[model samples]
Target: MDDATRIELEAATFRRLVAHLRERTDVQNIDLMNLAGFCRNCLSKWYRAAAEERGLGLDDATAREIIYGMPYAEWKDRYQREASAEQQAAFVEAIRKPDA
Candidate 1:
């Protein structure tokens, strides 16, 4: 496929992933970090960085809102829960090992 087609497909996939994450409110960021070593926050940071690369000024809060489909504080108040001991331990271990 051409570059434009590839870019379009990737953008569509990203949108779908963000939509899925928004729908799955029960899935906490810590859980995602423990499992995949990245979460919505990471995505937001990446989005912000990309915006900067293109001469845009996308702040953390705005990038997070884009990824969360709502304000970060509101999402946390509504859906975030305290991580369990096991979850915390897993996160630590996951971080110690490099991503595959």
Candidate 2:
């Protein structure tokens, strides 16, 4: 594919992923981090980084809002749950894995 087409496709895929995540509020970030090595926050950071690379001045809050479909604080207040001990241990182990 051409550069523009590839960019468009990537943007579309990102939007779909954000929409899916917004719909699945039951899936906690800690659980995602444990299983996938990244979560919404990581996506937000990557979004910010990509903006910077493109000379766009996007802040973390704006990037997170894009990913979370609202202000991250609001999402946390409504949907975030405290990680269980098992989840915490799994997260730590996942992080410690060299492949992760």
Candidate 3:
């Protein structure tokens, strides 16, 4: 595929992933960090970084809203749960993985 097509496809895939995450609110961030090593917050940071790369001054709040479909605080209030001890431990272990 040409570079433009590849970029378009990747952007589409990213949009779908964001939509999926917005739909799956029951999936807690801690659980995602434990299982997949990243969550919506990570994705937002990535989006923000990408925008910055293009000389676009996107703030954290806007980036998070784009990912969460709401303000980050609102999403936390609505969908986030307190992580269980096991989830916390798993997250710690996952983040500590060598060369990850």
- Residue-wise lDDT of candidate 3 within 1-100, one digit each (tens)? 9999999999999999999999999999898877887899999999999999999999999999999999999999998888888988888888788864
TM-score of each: 0.97, 0.93, 0.94
Clash pairs (backbone) in predicted model 1? none
Candidate with more favorable, higher TM-score: 1 or 2: 1
Clashing residue pairs in candidate 2, if any? none
Name the best candidate (by TM-score). Answer: 1
User: What tens-digit string does per-residue lDDT give for candidate 2 at 1-100?
Assistant: 8999999999899889989999999999998898888899999999999999999999999999999999999999999999999999998888788971
Q: List the lowest-lDDT window of 10 residues for candidate 3.
A: 91-100
lDDT of 3: 0.92
Error of 1 at 51 (Å): 0.1
Ranking by lDDT: 1, 2, 3
lDDT for each candidate structure: 0.96, 0.94, 0.92
Cα error of candidate 2 at position 2, Å: 2.5
* Candidate 3 residue 2 C-alpha distance from true site, Å: 1.2
- Runs of candidate 3 with Cα error greater than 4 angstroms are none
